[model samples]
Target: MENLFSHPESEPEPSQQDDDALEPFIITVVVPTNVSHAFQGFTDHPHLWWPLDQESVFGEGSHVEFEENLILETAEDGRTSVWGTIDDWQPPLSFHASWYPASTPLWSTEIRVSFRAVEEGTEVRLVHDGWEGAEDPAASRASYAEGWPRVLERYVRFMGGAVA
Candidate 1:
């Protein structure tokens, strides 16, 4: 469940004029399953592993659903929120999306997740980019940098990893 690759520690500040200069936040983790199963576990059953009760737009008692073109999070109270839009979806391989959870699409970033076969299991690599759309890209990236590891820890545990 450890990252086999790492990026540079120092990253450039993102600006609307120079958005492409900012490097995407990349993280990789190996899951104890094949590519297809890992892909299904992430796209089809996020509600089971995602920390919906804690880090979600609807707060506690929310569940996620990946629709044809959207990722929806619905609360127990019946209110729903759009987390992202599926731009490109290729099962058992990779998918790209515009992510804007808890906000409008106008301020969306981008996410790409890929699943590849490895010696141990499937290597799930996540790349978060497109900071130009955010009002405060650096802050958003920093926040997610802190948050994604925890979220992926939950996912790794769900994927049968001995994650502590």
Candidate 2:
């Protein structure tokens, strides 16, 4: 089967901060479905599979929001973005956004998630890069590395139930 998580030849390499600074962290987890099932549907159902520890800002008529006050707005064309109050929303098959912590120097970073179909399953690749402002890049990378697995596991389980 083809490697669904492979980056495009034109894609730029992740920025490197410093030798001691933590390198860009990328994690890919293959789900047993297509991109439509893996991203749009799975992500839209925040209530069923969102991280319990994180605060969600979703309601009957509001966009899905996160604890860091990031608002996830979906366009009519099926594009999604995590936007700040001032920034414009832009969408792509895979894109980047800022991950700002509440009390920090607004640590800027980008998270790119892509989905591709493969024979065995759908490859959900999550690449979080641009950790330039983090106090400890290594620690930051370790935390996200651990967190994505748990999040993806929950998503996979949830999707499995829907399929069954």
The TM-score values for the models, in the order shown, are 0.85, 0.59
Per-residue lDDT of model 1, residues 1-164, tens digit only: 65778776899776774554456989999999999999999999899999876679987678998998999999898988999999999998999999999999999999999999999999999999988787788788888888889888899999898775
Candidate 1 clash figure, as a count: 0
RMSD versus native structure for model 1: 11.2
Across 1-164, the per-residue lDDT of candidate 2 in tens digits comes to 76899867797756564443566677666666666776664545755665545422232333344323353644345544543221322222343456643323366555666777777567777777666666666677777777777767767777672222
Displacement of residue 32 (Cα, Å) in model 2 is 1.8
Clashes of each: 0, 0
User: Which residue runs of candidate 2 sit more than 4 Å off their true CA positions?
Assistant: 1-21, 54-92, 101-105, 161-164
What is the TM-score (0 to 1) of candidate 2?
0.59
Clashing pairs in 2: none
